[model samples]
Every structure is written in structure tokens, then in C-alpha cells.
Target: MPNAPAADQRRLLDVQALDTRLDQLAHRRRTLPELARIAELESQLADLHTALVTSQTAVADLRRELAKAEADVQQVRDRAARNQARLDAGQGSAKDLQALQHELESLAKRQGDLEEVELEVMERLEAHEAALAEVTAAHTQLVDGKVQVESERDAAFAQIDAEVAGVQSERATAAAGLDAGLTALYDRLRGQLGGQGAAALRGRRCEGCRLELNPLDLDAIKAKPEDAVVRCEECGRILVLLPEDH
Candidate 1:
């Protein structure tokens, strides 16, 4: 087994590296741009569906109105025909005939009004149908777009998962080579220090906290044994010295 302090430092470094990689993977998983686009597309699709439904309902209402108007015109024409036959038969008094003519004229006017209403309703129905076609086209486009976006998002997640799996395997291998006490200390320190237990010391600066060490601190670190573990005063992270050439 490695000495307690050296082993702890090594294990802490390994854990820090693994944790950094894990954080990167988690961030990639959560911040995919495609996911935001997918949500937007879904919302747009929902709105389009609502509009299409409303347009279809309007079209149905117009069709009903057209049918009713046609029926009314037919009923009026039938009444006019009956009135004309009664006037021609001369079986009614003059007053009765005059009333029948007035009624027939009223029926003609009502038939014309009903025909005009039917035409208007038909025109409105045609417009609604056109609008529905446009909505259906837009909906189809959105559906296809959503499918493509989802596929892209899934592919990105799959790639990230594979990377995470590889990183985990490497972490396991690294952990296996470390002493148990070192691993325990590393885990404890990492838990206490926001997932970071080790950092590199460059020149007289602590990379963990980006703070320069005082002259006394630098001298003390330099005086320590080559294999001794040192910690950063500012950040409480284990400091690893770089080689002279680095």
C-alpha cells in the first residue's frame, strides 16, 4: 500500500478528474439546444391544431346554415306553386285570390333572400375549407420537423451516454489501483469541497482558487518532502506540484 498522504493525494486527483468529466456529461445532457427547439415546435403544433379545429367547426356551422337556407327556399317555392294552382282554379273569392297573390309575392321575396343567404354561407364555407387546408399543411410540416429534431436529440444523448460509460469504466479502473483509506479520504474531501478535492499548483498560485500564495506559504510548500501531500490554504484543496519543465 502507498503511504497514507501520497495515496490520498493520488486518489483525490483521480476523483476530481472523474467528477469533472461527470459534470461535463450531465451538463451536455441537460443543455441540448435541440431540446429547446423541440419544445417550441410542440407548442406551435398545439396552437396549429387548435386553429385547425376552430376552422373546421366554423366550416361545419356554415354548411349547416347553407343546408337550412336551401331547405327554406324549397319550402317557399312549394307554397308559391300551391297558391298559383288555387288562383288558377278560381275556387276562392277575389279577396282570397288577392291574399294568395300577396302571400306568393312574399314567398318569392323570402325565397330570394334565402338563396342569397345560401350563397353567402357557401362562400364562407369555401374560405374555411381553404384555411383548413393551409392548417393541415403546416401541421404536417411541424410533425416532420419534430420527428427530425427528436431524432437528433436522441442521437446526441446516445453519444453522451457512451462517453459517460467509457469515463465511468476508466474511473473504476483508476479507483481499483488506489488504497482504500486514500479513496475514503478523497470521497470525504470531495463531498465537503463541492466535488473538487485536488488541484494543480502552478508557480506560486493555487489553481483551485486562483489565489497566489504568500512568500512564507511558498517557502513552506517548497521545504516539504518531495512525496508529502500539500493543501491550498485558500481553497482547502490538495495541491499537486507541476514538474520543473512544466
Candidate 2:
């Protein structure tokens, strides 16, 4: 029902093209591969960190166990040594000497048992330490990988953002000074019609919906003045009638 210069109606196609490109750019930003990859890497890093912490805790507990085992062995050994020295001085009765000898035997056996416990704890501590070292190294490698991927992701973001900026500027220029009513109608239709407000009528086809206009509709559209605005019956989009060379 509105009117615009024939040239302005055709220029609206260029504006539509720019808008479509902008939409594509926005979709590209949302579906960037780096975003998914980064999320995956972060999840792996979180699991690896938990494993590393668990390994470290096991090593710490083993170390404490080894220390207590060593203290127990040393205490038994010190007591046996003092008992031997007193027995050698021969300053007590036979009963006392006999009792001291029996006690020496008990102390020697206690020392042997304690030494076995110490050795077992030492072996366990060594194994846990080795496991901790392996986990630490793996965690460090994962962290490095995450950092590298993050850098790549940032570079990708910068590139896409720059392209979006360029496309937006072009769109602004293309839409500038367009017929106010036409532009307003186009925007409202675009909001309702999946980002396409206008499309060309090539032959009988409405490019917006990819459907052919009926002969009656096509004839009616063709009868309109060159400056008269028309909409496609199939899609409800402004139909720009470009001049056919043939």
C-alpha cells in the first residue's frame, strides 16, 4: 500500500543481503567449535585435579605412618641397649640377673617385630610417592593443554568479533535513509518471519518462501505501478520486482 522509488525498492534487497550476512555471523559466534572444545577441556581438568589431590593425600598419610613405625623400632632398640649395659656391669643378684636376661630376650623379639612394621610402612610410602609423582605430572600436562586451547579460543573469538563488527557497519549503511514506513514494516515482518523481511520475485517464485505465486497473483502483482510496494501472497514479505533483461 506504501510507495518508494523503484531504485529504493531494489536497494532494499542489498539491505536484506547485509542483514542475512549479519545473522550468519551471529550464528557462527554462537556455534564456534572452540567453545565446545574449551568446555570439554575444563571438565577434564577438573577431574584430573581431584585425582591429583587424592594421590597427594594418600602420600601424606603414608609418610606419617612410616614416621610412627620408625619411632617404635628405635624405642625398642634403645631399651635393649640399656638393658645389655646393665647386665654386663654385674651389679645385681642372680634373680635380678635372670630377670634381666629374660627381659633382653623379649626386647630383641619386640625390636624384630617393630623393624618388620617399619619396613612394610617404608615400602608402602615409596609406592604412594611414586603414584603421587605420576598424577602430578599428568595434571601439569592437562593444565598446559587447557591453557593452549584457551589461547586458541580467544584468537578465534577476536577474529569472529572483528568480522561481526564489519558486517554490522555495512548493514547500517545499507539500511540508512530507506523509506521509513517500508523499513518499519520490514523490521516487524523480519521479527515474525525468521529474519527475512523481503525477497525478490524471480519469474513466478517468491524467494522468501521458495514458493511460486499463482498466475492470478502474479498478474495482479505485474499490473502494479513501478513505484508501488507489493507483498508476496505466499510469504507476506515485500516482493521487490527487479527488472528482467529478457
Candidate 3:
């Protein structure tokens, strides 16, 4: 059978109080609303950045295509100009002049077709550039929003950390008065029992689980000597007895 001296048993209630406060602080830290808001903002910012990158890539590709199209049109136009000068100079043989004139006409038709392609590409490039600009602006705004959210979350973390520090100090003082063996037992049982290792026996109930003891269990607990470490038969929690209340 396990037993705690009178002083150790009294400290159990203090330990339980400190442990419960610490648990509440931890739970509050995890459930802060700022944490959820920060997550939502970060998710939105990621999507905006991805959209901006896609838009910028599309604009860049179309600009390159436009550049190549313009160069092709200019190259063909220069060839036609040289052929026109040769025909105008009247220096070629008659057969050669006729061939030069025919070549000029073919170059003119090709230049017209290429100019049409250049116009289409220019329009497409303009649209893409506009889309890129809009996305870039939106992405910039989202980044700023993310920064604000981070600041809020950091501030919340600091506040919670301060509260936790205070509670930890309180718990240290409470734990110092307990017997080493009893405290170790409580720590071990807490790990297995979801953070609660002991409860007071008040009005025939184990306060940890709020279950009322039946006649047999109550009788057994009543038979134990004061200062004897007694566990609840119903829930296996170390049950503390208050002489005045019992």
C-alpha cells in the first residue's frame, strides 16, 4: 500500500491547482484567434504570388514573340527596298531587270502577311502586360497584409509567453513543497491520464471525472486511515480527503 505523510497529502491540492492553471494557459496559447487569422492570410498571399508569377511569365513569352515578328517584317521590308533601287537604276540586263521586278512584288506580298502577324502578336502582348501589371499590384498589397498579420501574431505570442512564464513560476513554488515520491507519482499518472493525476473526494464524488462513488467504493475509501494514499476504484485517480468536509 502507498502512503503520504500529512504535509505531502496537503501539497497535493496545491499541486493540482497549479497544474490546472498551467493547462489552461497552454490551451489558451494554442487556441488564440490571431493564429488562425495569420494562417488564412498566408494562404491567400501564396495564391496571389503564384498568380503574379504566371502572369509575368506569360507576358515575357509574348514579348519575345513580338520581338521576333517585328525583326522578320523589317528584314523582308529591307530586301524589297534593295530590289526597288536595282529596278529604278536601269543598270541590269533586260532579263535580269524583269526578274528583279518580279522578286520585289513577291517580297511586298510577304511583308504584308508578316505585318498582319506582327499586329496580332502586338495586341496579345499588350493584353498580357496589362494582366501582369494588375497581378503585380495585387500581390504587393497581399504581401503587406501578410506582414501585418505576422506582426499581430508575434505580439500575441509575446503576451502569451509572458503569461506562461508567470504560471511556470507559480508552479515551481507549488511543486517545491511536495514530497519527491508523491510528485513523481503524480507526474507519471498525469502522463497516462490526460494531465490529471489526482482529484478531491467531495460529497462522495471524484472531482477529476465527476463520477459519484457507489456504496462499496465509498465504504472502502471511508475505511482508509487519514494520510493513506487512496485511489478511486471508479476512475483510478488519487482521491484527496478533507477531514472537515468528510
Instruction: Give each model a TM-score.
Output: 0.79, 0.88, 0.85
Task: Give the per-residue lDDT of model 1 (tens digit) for 173-215.
Answer: 7777665655665677678887777787788888788999998
Model 3: how far residue 186 lies from native, Å: 0.7
Give the deviation of candidate 3 from the true structure as CA RMSD.
2.6
Kindly list the per-residue Cα lDDT of model 3 for residues 1-246, writing each as its tens digit.
578775677678778887888888788888888788778877887888788888988988988999999999999989988888888999689999999989988998999999999999999999989888888888888778778877887888798789888878988887776777777778887888888898888978889889998878788777878768887777777888877634
**Winning model by lDDT:** 2
Residue 73 CA displacement from its true place in model 2, Å: 2.0
Ranking by TM-score: 2, 3, 1
The positional error of residue 141 in candidate 1, measured at the CA in angstroms, is 1.7
Would you give me the overall lDDT of model 1? Answer: 0.82
Go through the candidates in order and give the C-alpha RMSD of each one to the true structure: 3.7, 2.4, 2.6
Number of the top-ranking candidate, with TM-score as the measure: 2
Indicate the TM-score of model 1.
0.79
In candidate 2 the C-alpha lDDT for residue 217 amounts to 84
For model 2, name the residue pairs that clash.
Answer: none
Q: Which has the higher lDDT value, candidate number 1 or candidate number 2?
A: 2
